[model samples]
Target: MSLSLVHSRALLGLEARPVCVEVHLANGLPSFTLVGLAETEVKEARERVRSAIQNTGLEFPANKRITVNLAPADLPKDSGRFDLPIALGILAASGQLDARKLAGYEFAGELSLGGDLRPVRGALAMSLALAHLANDGAMPRDKPGMPARQPKLVLPEGSAQEAALVPDAEIYRAHHLLDVVRQFLPGDTPPEVLDGWTRIAPIPRREQADYPDLADVKGQAAARRALEIAAAGGHSVLMMGAPGSGKSMLAQRFAGLLPAMTTEEALESAAVASLGGRFALENWAVRPTCAPHHTASAVALVGGGSPPRPGEISLAHRGVLFLDELPEFPRAALEALREPLESGTITISRAAQRAEFPARFQLVAAMNPCPCGYLGSSLRACRCSPDQVSRYQGKLSGPLLDRIDLHVEVGALAADELVNTPPGEASASIRGRVVQARERAIARQGSTNQALEGQAIDAQCQLDDAAAKFLNTAATRLGWSGRSIHRCLKVARTIADLAGAATVQVTHVAEAVQYRRALKAAH
Candidate 1:
């Protein structure tokens, strides 16, 4: 046989698109060429594939002309993930292995010069795509004409565990080229099993996170209460405080107070990390925490480029995006966040294609009171004038601040309070309350408060007469927008949840109103 076909997958954003690797051997000039919109790394696969085949003690078909093409040429191919498929194609085309048995399997790996398979990124995404195909009736199942067999996924040994996470897919881990051949071809010698050949174990839960305990942060009781509300509702928060006020510390610990990741959330988060090439397979259910520098560009923050890979925000999906020194970030990047903040997803468009990445992250931002960091400090004298303070505060736009549901002020702790531990609640204890609050929100509204929109908030977050009167008075007096009113209701709903109340009381609405008032006064 002079022709062979193997299946592979190409990553487009967080999605995996199927690619057909076709190999053809002909009586023409002795050369090897790769076609179908291959990028530099993919084009260089010819050399890697050739060397890998020869190193495996297999015939490389030196005198024959060989052509390999990735079908669906319009989609750009950009990685060495095609190496295993290309090598298999060459072996089959050279009559060294049977290609007939390779039909239902998808192969992805980077090959070392010695034909050892190296792990590639996005294995989770590829497995997910295959799983979706099977679920959607797109995969061929055993029927009258079709043979009943699950689709096999061949991945690098290091990535087998991640791929195996998907049910209904047979995962085969390959350490070397010969292992692949032995698995598919009859009478072929099986390669030696590697030392770490056992199935990949799911990521272990951390006995304890590195975050600071709420008990350690003295004073700022109101700020801590607001943090609980934000945690319960999955709402974005802004903390304004002078230096050494524990603003950043509170934000860092917010993630620990969040509910544990569900299986679906873990899979979605894992898939996003896989696409970003940062997923640690051993840490399966751990949520991500992204804290990019304030100097990061819009592309770095929101995800954009020539090929359009995910950025910090997308990497923080189902996790936290903590921005310290919030006002220091460039205006453009901060403004670019407005859309994703509202939609819970970011869309990056290139001339060729547009990709959407999930960014349902909790935004936790902290900023100093002024450029000198002592505008409201009890210990330090203010160094900046009114103009400087105004300019510094103005760096954060009103519209952006409006989207943030909770605005907390972390006041400086008293000198005596710093040394005395007041026996505050630990993160686990706070997390228990947060989990209960979230359960109530989910049970009552079918979503988090952050996800509530126009009608949904009205339907679920109904306030009594006194609560409504207080909110209306506050809105009129504070000049709050409709969006701000809705945000306040969401925050109040969260506050009610934290208090273990079935309804939003007058006091809950009053506390939510205070957070907004404090922010308005601070600016």
Candidate 2:
């Protein structure tokens, strides 16, 4: 056989698009060439593949003109993930292995000069893409008439295990190029001791995941309540406080107040982590908490690159994104969050292509009340002038503030008060109420209160006559925008859920109103 084809995948955002490696050896001046929109990293695979094959005692087509093309020329190909496939294709084309045996199997891995296979990124994403294709009747058939068998994924040990996490996925782990060669060699007999290759099974972690307990923080009842409400409704929160008021501590423990993840949620979260090359078996089924520093660029907060990758918010999908010292973040970065916060997704558009990443993360942000951190504090005087305070608070635009549903004040606890205060309620107890409230919201509307839209909000949050009048008067007096009023109603609906009330009452409306005014500058 003078021509051979091998299959692989390329990471484009979360979707793993297919790529075909075609190798041809013909009589001409000895040369090596790789084409089809390959980046420098991929073009370098030619050297790695050649070295690996030669080092493994295989015949390299040194005297023949060799050319490799990653088909579908428009798709941008990067990384050394195609190295293994290119090597296999070359060997098969040069008559060293059985080219026909490569059918029904896909390969992805980087190769060392010693022929050792190195893991690639987006293994789980590729596996999930295969599953999606199969379910959607789009998985390509190896041959038109043969009975279909599940596609086998050949990857490095690390990536093989990650791919096996997908249900019903067939994964084979190969430690070296020689291991893969032995499988597809031109023979029906199996190797006597194929120690380097084995099938991997999905290993779902059985143990319960643990997080920081909310009981560690004391004497911030209002802030704790707000965290519970935010967790229940999937609402973003802003905490304003003087220094040493435990805003960060509360935010850190906020994830523990949410319900446990479903299997679907866990798989989606782990798949995203795998795409970012940050997936770990221990972190499986555990909700993530991403806390990027205030100095992070807007591109880092939201995803953007030559080939788009997930940012902090997407990595925190189905989890929490805590931005401590919120006002200290770059204005551009802060503003970039507005769209994703509302839409639960982010679309990054480059000149050549556009990619969308899921970013349905709960936001927990905290900031000092003033530039001096003691504007309304009874313990210490604020040193900044009014203009300084105004400017510092003005860094967060009104539109951005409007997106945050809960704004709570966290006051500093006196020494005596801190010493005398008992351990506050544990997260387990608070999470019980939160989970129940969340269930009520999901049962009634099929989503969290925060996700309710135009007509859905008006239908689910049917305010009684008294509650309607109170909210109307408050909206008019406070000069609230339609968006703000809707947000307040969502919070009220959450409060009603917590109390197990049938409708949003005046008491619920009043409590929800308090949360909207904790930061005076937000007005």
Candidate 3:
């Protein structure tokens, strides 16, 4: 009897846990049995690995009893990610490859019947998990220095580039099963093929992130101002307007105004995207903008399942989540966003397991004022009655509205204004101002204005005496909740930062108050 072990990773939310693929070959009945909590796709690898080995002119030892077990018996394994490791384990156990050479290394990839290796999901997540395992991920090897012991990672060509993005990650890309087998041959006998295996080196990047220009929107200065403030301070926004009023257009362009992402932010964002299988190499470091339709359900909006996959909000981490026609979405779905909006994370609890995902997203939601699409529009009269409008707008609960930091009305533009208005400010010009304001906030409190907590809020937002007095009076008159008042203070602080002011003033408070009044009739 012979046994071999190959190391790999299992993804749970953003975390990647280590998994050991164990293969044992012994003289017994000619049957192959797979054990461990493997899903259908993983179990299906039995046929794939068998065919791949045989087609590559390698011995399968079909007469010998085969047993493949994924270690840590309770960890659920899914997808074709285990195919490569399982095949390699069998080869090592059958006395075809050197098993000891596999130490200090991990492998993941799907395999074709022709022995061609295919890309696997969460390649970046797997790389990051290895980094975290090395020295608790305290410092980047490239920045502070690599840990004393560095584990190598092997992946398919399609997925290797994404994994290589991690600084100092030793990533190897292979094209075929034969390519990987060559490395662990019983002895070092120079392989015939060279192109099939190559080390992927991390290259220095100087390219800037590209995004759609904001100059596409023509007018709506007030709505544009709200986007600027939201970008500068990391605040959420709710925009209500009539149809063809540039709500969706403005929401789509909102991501371009945010600051450039740091390397750490880029990794977190990419890891989440990788888990959802939506990550593209070209879109690396560019802030994402997820816009789910109104028909999405609560589970689809907040993320819930047997394994608990990330939802649209988590996919939009470090980016914008644009929900068009917000009031038309299911009431439960809209309400589920309340907690994540405030805490910047969402925890999905299942009967057996629980998973938490990061949802620090900038929400840019839009809606029509009433069922008829226009409640106060001068251009078109609303067809819905008073009660109909009330119920339609009431789909959004009070708590959800309170969590939003800015509310702006995107009014319908007159024909003359739409035709005559030149293109609004370019995204580059607006981004400059947003970056300056963000820098000021980071310098003062080491975070964005919206991230200020209880004592941090009072300590950072230094309101002048008159400004403080005005805020107190306004809160009393508006009947604002404590949450609403704090959000207003943060908005005021952001406004003061944009203007290069040392302290919050009455004018800043007055403008901030206007944002809260836009949705007074909704809830």
Q: Pick the candidate with the highest lDDT.
A: 2
Q: C-alpha displacement of 460 in model 2, angstroms?
A: 0.7
Top-TM-score candidate index: 2
Per-residue alpha-carbon lDDT of model 1 for 392-499, expressed as tens digits? Answer: 989989999899888888888778878774756788888888889999989988899889998899988899999999999989999999999999999999989888
Task: Report the CA-based lDDT of candidate 2 relative to the real structure.
Answer: 0.91
lDDT of each: 0.85, 0.91, 0.90
Better of 1 and 3 by TM-score: 3
lDDT of 3 at 188: 71
- Pull out the clashing pairs in model 3: 141-145, 141-146
Q: Which pairs, if any, clash in model 2?
A: none
State the lDDT of candidate 3 residue by residue for 1-523, as single tens digits: 2999999998777788889999999999897889989989999999999999999999998999999999888987888999999999999999999998887679999999999999988899999877776657543354445455567899999789899989878999999999999988887776555798999988555356888888999989999999999999999999998999999999999998998888888889988888888998778888999999999999988888877789999999999999999988998999999899989999998877788999999999999998879888989988888889888878889999999999999999999999999999999999999999999999999999999989999998888999999999989998999999999999999999999998999999999999998867443
Clashing pairs in 1: 203-282, 203-283, 203-284
Residues 425-472 of candidate 2: C-alpha lDDT, one tens digit per residue: 999999999999999999999999999999999999999999999999
Q: 346 in model 2: Cα distance from truth in Å?
A: 0.7
The count of backbone overlaps in candidate 3 is: 2
lDDT of 3: 0.90
List residue ranges in candidate 1 displaced over 4 A. Answer: 144-149, 186-212
